[model samples]
Target: MEVAPQLRPRAGLEVVAGDVGEAVPSYAQAFQVVVNIEVKPVATVPRRTPGASEEADRLWLEHARTAAVIDDEGCFLVRGADRDWVRVRRTAHTALSAALVPGAGSMVIAMSPDGRRLCALTEEDDDYWIVVHHFEDPLM
Candidate 1:
């Protein structure tokens, strides 16, 4: 008997631009990519409580939704909560977002030739670090 092949799941990044009031307060801008970039709102969470509205929760979600950016090459630049960059593969169905990085500031600089590592420039002492992000899809 012949066995059927299994289909693998797809994943990608979803980025949204939040309103100025909703964006998380930061001394530095939220997103900055050296390469070509596009910012779009990917998702939003409705007010959970019935007949209730919490501005804080709504604002937090808005900020979370705004911190992701993807390039044509399928690499993603996600700003983590600690103000560090989290690089990941751009999956088709999976939605990912990053919070503000800590310290003065940081930004994504470049992608490795092998498309495996990401370079980030930190504001403190003008330092830089290489980060490795694993993609769910090997081809991506």
Candidate 2:
């Protein structure tokens, strides 16, 4: 019997866009993958007044979604869901959408090249992780 060498992913390259609406190139050059993030400003909070003077407004992102493509190797996409993905910073207010709640089906962490395996990132104990998943029936 013979065994093949193991392969692992290199540290992914980073891309920064000036705005959330900018287009990201689909071609994978000099990198194993490419990623972009989308964020929306949902709230404005006032910081603690210094010396009882004027306070500054801090913007908060209520929703954030990230998309990634690994050329022909694979792809990844995920969104921050549940309770608007953020709370009012330094405030006791929480925003819960009555119409658009994040659900399990809307999340797509990653997909295998052969389309056999799926991956997802889950939060546990304030830590995030990649969890590979298998489907009972492979989609066509």
Number of the top TM-score candidate: 2
**If scored against the real structure, what TM-score would every candidate get?**
0.23, 0.24
Residue-level lDDT tens digits of model 1 in 1-140: 11011101211333333221222222133223222234222222232335212332233223323332234455443443344333344444442112213343433332322333233322222222222222222222
Regions of model 2 farther than 4 Å from truth: 1-108
Which 10-residue window in model 1 sums to the lowest lDDT? 1-10
Q: How many residue pairs clash per model? A: 13, 0
Using lDDT, give the best candidate's number: 1
Displacement of residue 69 (Cα, Å) in model 2 is 12
lDDT against true structure, model 2:
0.22
Model 1, residue 26: distance off in Å is: 9.1
Candidate 1: C-alpha RMSD after superposition: 16.7
The global C-alpha lDDT for each of the candidates, from Candidate 1 onward, is: 0.29, 0.22
